[model samples]
Every structure is written in C-alpha cells, then in structure tokens.
Target: MVLYFLALVFGLHIVMVNLGIAFSTVIPILKRKGEKENNEIYLRTSKQLMNFYAATYGLAGVFGTAFTVFLLSFYPSFIGLAGHLTFIPFGIAILAIVVHFFAITAYWYSWDKWKSDTHFLIGMILLISVYLIPLGFRAISAFLNLPQGLELTPKPHLDVVAALLNPTFLPLYLKSVTAALAAGFFTISSAYMLKYGKGDKEAIKIVEKFMPLATIAFTIAIVLGIIYAETLNLFVNYKFENAFGFLIAAKAKYDFSWLFIIKLAMFALQTIAIVSYLKIRKAWRFSKYIVAAGPASLIAIFAGEMLNSFSQYPYFVAKLADKEFVSSIPQPIRDYLAERLNLELSNPLATSMGLYTLTLVFLVPLLISAVIFLYILLFGKERSEALD
Candidate 1:
C-alpha cells in the first residue's frame, strides 16, 4: 500500500516536472531560433507557454514533497543507505533545483527587460540544470536497484565521481532523459493542440516535429533499456543460473515480457503512424493522427515504467533487500527501522478499494486541469511582443 501510494505520487511528479522542464527548455531553443529567423510566432508561443510552465513548476514542488515524505517514511533503511551512498549527487541536485527555480523565475519576469539574450541565457542555464537534475536522481535510483554503488558502512566514505557514475547510471540517465525529452516536446504540442485545436499551423508544426522526434527518442530509450536489461540479466544469471541465459532475467517466476512486447508494439506503431501522417499531411484525417501522437507516447511511457517495476518485483531496486530464494534481508532491514519506517503492506489493495482510490487520484487532477484549460480560454491572456 505504501509503495503503491508513493508510486502514484512519484508518477504524478514525473509528469508534472517533465512538463515544466520541457516547456522551459523549449523556450530558449525557440527564442534563440526566433531571434535568428525574425519569427514572431516562436517568441510569442514561448512566452504564452511560460504561464503554464510557472504553474507546473509550482505543482511539481508539491508532489515532490509528497514523494520525499513517502520515501523517508516507507523505505527508511533503503533510502537511508541511498542518501549516504549518493550524497554528492543528491546534494548537487538540491542546489541545482534552487538555482533552477530562481533562473526560471527571472526568465519569466524579465522578458521585456531589454536584455533578450541575457534572459534566454538564464533559461538555457535552467534548461541544462533541469536536465542534470534527473541524472542525479537516476544515479541514486539505479544504484538502489542494482546495488551497484559503493556499499555504505557504519563509517561510509564516498568517491564523488565513482558514486555519481554507478554501473546503471549512464543507461538509466540516458533512458530517463530520452523519456523526459519525449514527454517534454509532446507536452508542448499537447498544450497547443488543446488550446488552439489541430488546425493551428504552429500547433500542427509542433505536433509534426514532436511526433517523429518522440518516436526517435523512444526508440533510443528502448535501445538503452535493452542494454540495461542485459546487464540485469548478467546479474541474474550469475546469481540464479541462466535466468536470462546472460541475455534476459532467469528469474522467470513472474515475467513481464508481455508488457515489454506491448510497449515495443506501441512505439513501432507510433512511428509508422507518424511517418504515414507526415507523408500525406494534407489528408483530412491528419489532424486526428497528429493528435493521437501525444496519447500514444504517454501510454508508451506508462508501459515502460510498469514493465520495469514488475520486472524488478519484490525489491524497490533489485537485490537490495530481496528475500526470495537466496535473498531475505530487506524485510529484516525494514524491521530494524522501528515503527514509523517499518511497514509491511501485503498488496492491501482490494479490487474495490483499488478502483475507488485510483478513481479519486485520477479525477482530482482531471478536474483541476479542466478548470485551468477553461481559465486560459476565457482570459485570452496572450503574449506581448519582444522588448524593444
């Protein structure tokens, strides 16, 4: 129950933070190009989207807090070890977020400050920092999963570079960055589609570019994921004798191969669909297909996360505290944490409870988003021209 709750919060955090980061990220890119091309459309759209970026950034902080609370409360021992082991990356990430917050704030308000390049530079810095932020997290998460980082002791010492560069760090970082980019660009396209409908040319262009880009990004993610899976397989094969035959996990007791297959099919179909749509972009049905890109990519993202989660099974990170066959220490470690941190929820989600909880969790956001959409529609608070 606790893990499920945390997963929900973290997933929402992922979506929201990715939205904010991607929107702000595209701003500088578009602004740089807009200035170069003398294009008003790019500059105007970037400014308009900044409004929503501010909102997403604020909401993400809320979910981020929830995620931290759940992590500390539910998985104290694991996170305790994690915090000590990857302290440097985690520390840097905090500083980065602080700077990122201030940078985005400055960029938002100084749009007409007669320092266009400087403002864009601020956004570029924010963009780079936002990109690095996830890498820090993935470093810790990957370490936790693979137990690949320096094993902490009563008196632990971390080698900053080595800790930040855990065995699973690069693959996980690339995979997540690709995922964020896909989500990020699609989000931009999504905002336009929902606001202006598919007929808007700028919206159409964004939709078109993001579609193929998402397909490419997702494809790269798949490749990186495959490499990560092979690494996991090697560990399993060594520990459990040919589970993946050194190519897949030999721990086949519960297989999510089907989920992986479905995810692959979705991406392949998305690519094919986007390519077909682009080729005959004038077709009357083009709008619908372009619109479909957003949902397909989102579903792909969900599927990938689900498959990864199930594949790891009992461990938050595989083998960290796993107590199956030859693994049995995770539960004991949790017990060591005392009452507040020690929680054992045996899939406490009854079917009815599951349905009810999921409905409420999803509906609240849907309603809030609907209200925001309507507010933007009514206000028509469009962008002003560049500072002259």
Candidate 2:
C-alpha cells in the first residue's frame, strides 16, 4: 500500500519534471524561430508552453518534496546513506532548481518589456538550469544502481566525479532527454488537437509541426531505453534478466518481466495511435486516434518508470551476487549498517499517520493543481485569468 502511494507520487513528479524539461528545451528555440521568422503562431506557441510549464512547476516541486519525505520516512537508512555520500549531487540539483525558477520568472515577467534577444538569453538560462537538475538527480540514481564511486569502508565516501560520470548515468540521461521530448511534443500536439477540434484552424498547424517531432523523439526514446537496459545488465544482471531475458540464452523469469512487457505493449499502442493520426489527421471520422495518442504516450512513460523501479524490488540497491556485491562495501561499514539499519517497517503507527497526513496535505493539492493545469492547457483563454 505504501509502495503504491510512493509510486504514485514519484510518477507524478516524474511526469511534471519531464514535461517541464521538454518545454524548456523547445521554448527558447521556438521563441527564437518566432523572432527570426516573425511568425505570430510560433511566438504564441512558445508563450502557451511557458504558461503550461509555470502551471505544472508548482505541482512538480510539491510531488518532488513529497517523494523525498516518503524516502526519508520509509527508508531512513537508505536515504541517510545516499544523502551522506551524494549530497554534492543533491546540492547541484537544488541550486539548479533555484536558478531555473528565477530564470523562468525573469523570462515570463519581462516578456515584451525586455528586448527579444535579452528575453531569449533568459530562456536559454532557464533551459540550462532545468537540464542541470536531472543531471544531478540521475547521478544518485546511477550510483544506486551501480554504487560506482563509493568507498564504503570504515565510513562511506563518494568520488564525486566517478559517481557523476558512471556508465549508467549517460544512457539514463539520454533516455530522459528523448522521453521528455516525446512527452512534451505529444502533449503540445494533443492540446492543440483539442483546440483544432474546437474549430481553431490555426491549431492544426501546431499539431502538424509537433506530431512529427513527437514521433521521432518517441522512437529515439525506445532505442535509448533498450541501451539503458543493456547498461543496467552489466551491473545488475538479475534485474535485467527479470526485465528482458536478453542474457546468454536465459529466459526472463516472470518476476517483473510482465510489467516491462506491458510497458512495451503500451509503447506499441502509442506508436499505432501516432501513426494512425499521421495517416488520417484530416479525417474527422478517425479523430479518436488523435485523442488516444496522448494518453497512450503518457501511460507508456509511466509504465516504463514502474518497470524500472519494481524490477529492482526486494533490494534497496540491487546486486548480482552477495559476495560480488559486498566487495565494494567493506566489512566494517557493512557491520555498522547491519547493526543499525532496520529495513522492515519499524513503526506501523507512525507510518500510518504519516501516510494519512501526506495524503491530505500533498495528494489533495496535487489533484487540484492537475485539474487547474489541464483546464488551462485545454480550454483557458490566450491570456490566463489565473496568472494575470
């Protein structure tokens, strides 16, 4: 039950951040294109995306904090150890987020007040800052998967460079970039599709522009994801085997393979929906395919995230073999952790109370915010009344 809630919050955070990063990547380029070409439609699209990003940013921060709190609450020892070793990466992510927030504010508020070039510069700053966040966060994820730079002897120590540049990190980061692009473009396409359905002829142009980009990104994401899985296989073979069965003549044990298979199925469905939309975009009778494409892409992304985490189940940091995995963590530190760490639920009462409180505090607000964002994206006027 707790794991479900954790997954829920984490999924929400991932979606929010992914979409935000996607917008960050394209918004500046769109703005520049608009300026150079003097196209009102491109400028309007950029502004709309900026508004969408602003709408989701709050929800992203909330979900991220909730995820952190859940980790601290449910898995204190793991969180503590990870933080102690990878605090620099955490610091980097936090600083990047702060800078990103300020840059976005400056960009949004100074829209027409500032010169076009100056505004574009701020947008670029926003893009760089947003990208840095995942760079820092993914380092910890890479370390969790492979613990590449840690000297877990008398006390745990981290080699910041090695940890940041772990083999797993680059693949995962690239996958994220591709996924973000796919999600962002598809989302924008979907939103404009809604507008096009509402008889806004100009909106079809946006859909036409974004759909191809979305499809290309989605294809790249799938390839990058396969590469990422191969990278994981090098370190955590069991999890990989459970996921893909791609190891030397070994079949995937049906542990978490089913989840991955379902994710793939979702991916296939999204591809079909996208292809169908591309083929019959002018046919009103087949409009449902266009509508299905967005949710299909989102579900596939969520399923991939679910498969990634759940496949590594029954272990905080997955390993190949006990003896092999423990080689990096010296006996003293192992003994210390063994003595102090209680991996199981230590206080059910506290856990229950925490869950209840967080559901009320975080979950309610998240739902409300999501509804507001959807409304703004789908139906709100050009000038958002909520923002103005």
Candidate 3:
C-alpha cells in the first residue's frame, strides 16, 4: 500500500509540475509569435488550458497537504525536526494556488482588455509563481533529507540554511526542474496532436519545433539526475545494494530484483520514445507511439521511486533507537500478534485509499454524465464536429 501511494504521489507530482511548466511556456511562446490568427486561437485555447493547469496544481497542493498531514499523524516524533520544513513546502503550495487563481481571473477578464498591458503582466507573474513555488517546495524537501542535518531527536548539529545551500542541492534542483520541463514538453506535444492533428499546419509546425526542445530537455535532465544522484552518494556504503541484495536474510522472501528490472525497462522505453520523437517527421503515423511512450516512461520512473521510498520505510524517521524501526520490535511480540490476529506491524507509510474508496463515487460519475449531456444539449451536432 505504501508502495502504491508513493507511486501515485510521485506520478501526480510529476504530472502537475509538467502541466504548470508546459502551459506557462507555451502560452508566452504563442503570444510572442507574429501570426495574428494563430495567436488569437492560441490565446483562447490557452485560457482553457490555463484553467486546467490551475485545477491540476490546486489538486496536487491539496493532496500534498493531506499526505504531509498523514505523515505527521503516523510519525509524531518527526514533527519536531521535519514538520517545519514540511510546512515550508506547504507554504509554497499555498502561494502557488493563490497565484493560479489570480492568473485565471485576470485571463477571464483580459480578453477584451488586452490593450492594457497590466493583464499581460499579471499573467506573466502568475506563470513565474507557478514555476517557482513548486521548485522551491521540492528543493526544501530535498534539503531536509540531506545527511548533514541535525539529528531530529536530541542533537542540533548542522545549520538548516547551510544544509539547504549544499552544493548537491542545486544540482538536484536543476535536474528536477529539467525533468518537469521534459514532462511538460511531452504533454504539450500530446495536446497539440490531440487538438490540431493533420488539419492545423501552424500548430503542427509549432509542435514539430517544440519536440526537439523537449527531447533535449529530457536528455539533459536524465544526465544531470544521474550526476546528482552520484553526488549524493545514494549508493554509498552499499545502502541500495545491501537492502536489496540477492543474499536475503533467512526469513526474508522477496528481493528487490523486480525493482531493478522495472527501472531498466523504464530507461529502455524512454530511450526508444526519444528516438521515435526525433524521427517523427519520417514516421508521422507513429507519433502516437511516442506519445504513449512518454506517459509509460513516467509510470516506470514512478515505480522506481516507489521502490526507493519503500526501501527506506524503516528509516522514515531517522536517528531513533533502532537503525531499522521494524526490526527493533520484539520478535516474540511480533510473532504472537501475527499468529493470533493475522496482522504484522508494517510501515506506517502503507496507508493509501484507492480511487474507488472515495465517498462521492456515484455522484462523481453522475456529475460527469450530466455535464456531457448539457454539452450535447447546448451545442447539438456542432460539438461533435468540433471534437472531431
């Protein structure tokens, strides 16, 4: 369950960041183009896109806050050391939500007011905030987990700001930003194909130009991520290898072989996707394959992150009496509980409510149906033609 939740959280985080960056970049680029007709069309489409982006960011922020609060509830001890840093990220998230709201409002009112530059400035400010807030939140989270931190329990050793300013942090931040940009590129490509397809020559041209940029961004992000991970010594002292080694303990059953395999597969798929995107003009029909590959690659990456997060479950709250918290509990007590109740003490991180578990499940589907019906009623056959 922890693995699943981590995977979901990681996937949503990547998607949200990508959407924010893609819309922010694409809107401005479209505006800057000298083609008046194309620009006008893009402006109208961008308003809708911006609304979607804002909703996505808002959802991500809400989920992030819930997840953080959940973590706080489970591991009350970490509150003293990590809670403040957690709130730091939450604060950024709030700022992002507020900025997005203002931006969307300004956009709605600016259609007739474009002559005044104030609306444009407001839009640009919102875009900047969208990019910066998420980046700041991610940076703060990464900083808090660095090795040079004050031990949460009793010892105060390292300076918080200094820890945040570490050499490794900046590289990681850059890598994260680039990854988000790459995700954004893929998203933009998908949107262009879905909306414009073969009919819109200008849109095709724009997408064609953007594809290479996305590819370049993704490549650089991967390279930088590798370097940053190495710099952090993520594999130092055999931390990964030992925990996931072939030589498992006597009672332990599953190894991390599946995780390694999944990671390798993800890497191979991303490589193929990149190659396919580069040759898109030659194999235009195969563009959908490349598009599909993008999301698949993200899923694979999410799986790998889940494995890493799960492996560190025992150490979720570090510097406690137990090097590994699960192992520290008395064996007989564990055994008796397991035997009598068929329950074993697992990682607290293993708490996730599946999508179907939500309370307004029926209402959600009903609402969606009603919205579709209303759209059909209002637009008649024109909606179908437009969609096609």
Name the best candidate (by lDDT). 2
Q: Superposing every Cα of model 2 onto the true structure, what RMSD results?
A: 3.2
Model 2 residue runs over 4 Å out of place are 245-254, 277-287, 320-322, 337-349, 353-369, 380-388
Per-residue C-alpha lDDT of model 2 across residues 8-67, encoded as one tens digit per residue: 889888888888888898888998998899988988888878876776688788888888
After superposing candidate 3, which stretches have Cα over 4 Å from the reference? 6-10, 34-45, 84-97, 108-116, 147-158, 195-202, 234-264, 282-286, 304-308, 317-388
Q: List the residue pairs that clash in candidate 1.
A: 145-317, 243-249, 243-250, 244-248, 244-250, 323-327, 323-328
Task: Write the number of the candidate with greater TM-score, choosing between 1 and 3.
Answer: 1
Query: The CA-based lDDT of model 1 is what?
Result: 0.62
Model 3 / residue 264 / CA error / Å = 4.3
The deviation in Å at residue 353 for candidate 3 is 11
Question: How does each model score on TM-score?
Answer: 0.77, 0.89, 0.69
lDDT of each: 0.62, 0.76, 0.53
- The residue-by-residue lDDT of candidate 1 on 1-388, one tens digit each, is 5656666667667767666656767778887787888888777777766756765576678768877866665556656766656678788778789888998888887876858779878988878888878867777666545555443344554666665666666876787777767766655555555544635555565555455666676567678877776665555323222123223544465566676666767677566655765675564234444455566666666666666555555555555334452243345544442232223432223225665477468747854874575365434463222211
Q: What TM-score, to 2 decimals, does candidate 2 have?
A: 0.89
